[model samples]
Target: MGNHDELICAFLLSGDKPGRELSWQEVQDWTPDQGNIWVHFDCTHPGTGDWLRAESSIAPYVLEGLLADETRPRCDSYDEGALIILRGVNLNPDARPEDMVSIRVWADSSRVITTRLRRLMAVDDIRNQMPTGKGPATPGQFLAKLAGRLIDRMGPVIDTLSDQTSELEEALIGSEEESNLEDMRHKLNELRRVAIALRRYISPQKEALRRLNHLDEDWMEEEVQGPMLEVVDRITRINEELEEIRERASVIQDELANRLAQRMGGTMYLLTLVATIIMPLSFVTGLLGINVGGIPGSENPWAFAIVCAMMAAVGIGMFMLFKKMKWLTIPK
Candidate 1:
């Protein structure tokens, strides 16, 4: 709505109404004397004392086209009726985008009106599912049906995330190599972001529905109330499961980091030991090689063999000392 280019809002009135569709411009010039039940669309401006009114903060022309962004899902009710806000899912699993499709619906006894800043999959899905010659009888019923389908669509998406999380857990257990660990970490973070987004968007709408359930409005009948409650319950459960998955991912990340650190420390210790053993040997060889003066065993024909034997003895002694201190591990 902020900077939207084109807005289109249409209303489908009750069967008794003369015209099937009424545009905002038409409503502005329309006179009630025409024997028509008025259903106005693109009426985003603040209302005066009209018999039935539907308005939006979003630009009116923005409702009818392809949406290039994403919006968080939400729901709200006014003094006269209800408003449902929904975000469309991006089915491409690998693509991460902040923009989402948004649909806003406002309804009353005689009319059902939908407005949007961008095209959404759920909106289209709901429109397509509407049976011929049987449009929504009331706004509440229309909203309930939309909410139910939106929650149901999320089932497959949540299932995919759960399966991916399980696969990551398996991979982590089987291999703790850097490459595998990094990949798993990336995937887990992505899943966490999706879960967090879903929870953030859907929570408000769930609360809205709960409020609607308590309202004394006549339009909110059993057909509307029952499905709305079910959708809310499903969303609540999904949010809880998402939290659990996030915790597991965090635990996996911490464990991997600790394991990597320990492995690095062990490798460093072994290298230091090897370097210490070689230092003394290098000194002994260098000093004995000096030809100028009294070098012990330098003049002997078997001096080289004596040097070799001496080095071996020193090496073995150091090895034994290290073994005693529990430095070197012997394979079983």
Candidate 2:
């Protein structure tokens, strides 16, 4: 684990034999001439930093980048090795997918070193495949495989956002409930935010992969170039899909806002019509309350009944007039 003092894993790769795990002592003693080695470390570990500073002999700038707390996707070739930083969706328990995790790599022809504060499934996939003699045989192939896995996992998450947006759009088409519309509005906003966050890393990562594929290096030879090109294509599509999802979410959000506004406007209009029809009837009744002698049949027992009947007829007539003028109807 990145939080621990131990090196995560160290493997000595034998092209024909299954990869063998190396102890800390063995890692310290190993060299390029013995065999190609892959060393993974928890960057946060104190021991890891001390070892890298004293033994790794990495350039100051590259070491700083590898140990930095925050980094965007990028590739910088130094000497014979390349320092690669890549981001993958955070798929840990209780984690938000949009909060991507980054892993840093320093890879050359014979030796590959990787560091991360957080564990990535893509790294684990490489670990699993190595023991079965089916994993990448070279540092270049390893990077390509890892990039592909990161992209492969992203497909479902992007598809999920697209599906949710579609479902919300359909619900908006059929939903008459104001409450449901309000809920959809919140969901659409959240979905759009996630899409933007995912794109933040993905866009830069696409460029990084492109630069890596085109870099003139011995390690990035013919066989490595082919797999890397595929990785570049996949990330490109992931970026495009995220953009589409963002646009679709925005359209749905706008449509929802307009519909909710019309609904509220129609309701308020109906209320205004009711108040208009009642105003004169209220005035007629209020007139009887005016203190005066011989107030228009106030002494007669039938006066109250006549006033009630008159108010009823007036209200009905006003309602019918409003209907005829289309004031009582709301446009669909």
Candidate 3:
């Protein structure tokens, strides 16, 4: 939409009936007698800021927050309403869930205004259900349902991370093959990045939900408290689970590093053993091959065979000594 058409969608809800769409003109003329109103806008649109400044009665700080390009999850309560910020997994095609999408909402007893940079599936879900009379009937229900929806979508993403981490842990235990560790390292890094990113938002999101649940507004009804608490609890669990996943990724990384070091140590030990045994043999061969006629092997072919046999015996003796010294075997 353009600046002149800033609204993405508007809804008018009645406790006695289902919600219906409201046009820009209707939204501008909406009165408390018309039941609750929800106006969703694409904040990036050219005229969105102008419309909010000129039409909405929201506080200056909340207005600035809603129009801002970036915001963290938070809730600021005001006498008129509360400016609440929340985030949901970026479920859009090609977008990573770690790059969460923010949904800024200003809500009170009778009106709600939400803005976003990208489409949120949770918002769509509520919009779709409103026609079926299954949507929130009041401003409090709206906030609670929106919070619930945002948290519900997060469950699957968190579960996926946990499941993948568990599988990696199993793989680490079963085998530490070089190629497998390489691939595991890549996946573990990605998982750690995702977990950290998610925890960054989810932690504040839980607090935001709690604040919304306890908002001082009359519209924040007692019935909404239960669902809001549930949302907060779920977000809290997601944060804790993300931390676990991150720790597991760290363990996987350490184990992989240890395995690589062990392999390298074994290879180095074998190379060192070969060099140790060959050093004396090479010295003897070089000394005998000297151009000086005093060299004993120069005149007798049997002398060459004797030297070869002696060198072989020396190599075997060195090998046995190394085995007995336990240098040939990897340390426990």
Candidate 4:
């Protein structure tokens, strides 16, 4: 491909057996009379918008969608062609899975063009399969296959979130260490954030896929409906799983908070009990230590011993009274 050709790869499918790659010149010269074609483009490339706006014979709305800066999952029909915008979990290096990448598509009976800003592994997987002569033969099959691949990649990421949530729940239940609790709390919050973000896009993407499955496209026939429905079902399952993970994470957080509150209440009760026992002893000592002329224990050495013994007795009595009142047991 030339620098002026943003085409990452273009396949001129001869009944699913991919022929030689098409250049920008060839793509521009191509037409529906030349069998089915699939063109993949990097929309961030400067040449892409120029070629799409000037050369491609797609509708104005479809062209706008292909070059859209941001879009949610949706499908719009125009004549026999369908314009679709879908999002997949970001799998790029150093990227969070929740930062989903968007793919825009314009598919008709004979051509399918897809564009994206970030590299999608699902797109690569299908592109790779074409070399083996074992890829989708028609535009409908290609759309179904692409949807399947996008949803398939989400399985591992969603499962990882679930596993992390489970681990956090177990840790919260089995451990009382402050540092460990903090770590688990942090992980839980991160998991929830990831799940929420994933669901944010995946939910709409699911609806979009469902719409595609039901779309009245001449290229997408009864033969393609089964696979398209399967893709829709897969997306539904993924969204349901994300919902479960989010709820479980929330439960773990609440449980952790309750446990911490109970621990704190017990600690505060014990401190209060200690203060209660010392208060009277402090008052008694202060009263007996006065050096005024008529102070009770000032003259006699025996009086000092008596005062000390009495203070000790009062301390013991207060402790015993607290024990009887069950104040030291600490409420749960």
User: Each candidate's lDDT (Cα)?
Assistant: 0.59, 0.86, 0.87, 0.86
TM-score, candidate number 1 = 0.71
CA displacement after TM-score superposition, residue 310 of candidate 1 (Å) = 3.1
RMSD of each: 6.5, 2.4, 2.2, 2.3
Candidate 3 segments whose C-alpha is farther than 4 A from its true place: 1-5, 286-296, 299-304
Question: Which of candidates 1 and 3 is the stronger one according to lDDT?
Answer: 3
TM-score (all chains, Cα) for each model: 0.71, 0.92, 0.92, 0.91
**Model 4, global lDDT:** 0.86
Q: What is the lDDT of residue 155 in candidate 2?
A: 84
Span of ten consecutive residues with least summed lDDT in model 4: 12-21
lDDT score, candidate 3, position 79? 78
State how far residue 33 of model 3 sits from its true place (Å). 2.5
**Candidate 1 residue-wise lDDT, 1-332, digit = tens:** 22222324333434332224444555445443432222322223323212232333333333322122344454555665555556545544454422434565555454455655434556555454433434454666666666666666667777877787788778878985777777777887787787777667656656766675665667777777777778778878866776777787787778777767767777887788898888899999888777777777766899899889999999989989998998885221
Worst 10 residues of 3 by lDDT: 1-10
Separately for all candidates shown, the number of backbone clashes (residues 3 or more apart, or on different chains) is 11, 0, 1, 0
Identify the superior model by TM-score, candidate 1 or candidate 3.
Answer: 3
**lDDT by residue for model 2 over 81-157, one digit each (tens)?**
89999999989889999999999999888888999999888898888877788777678777888888988878889
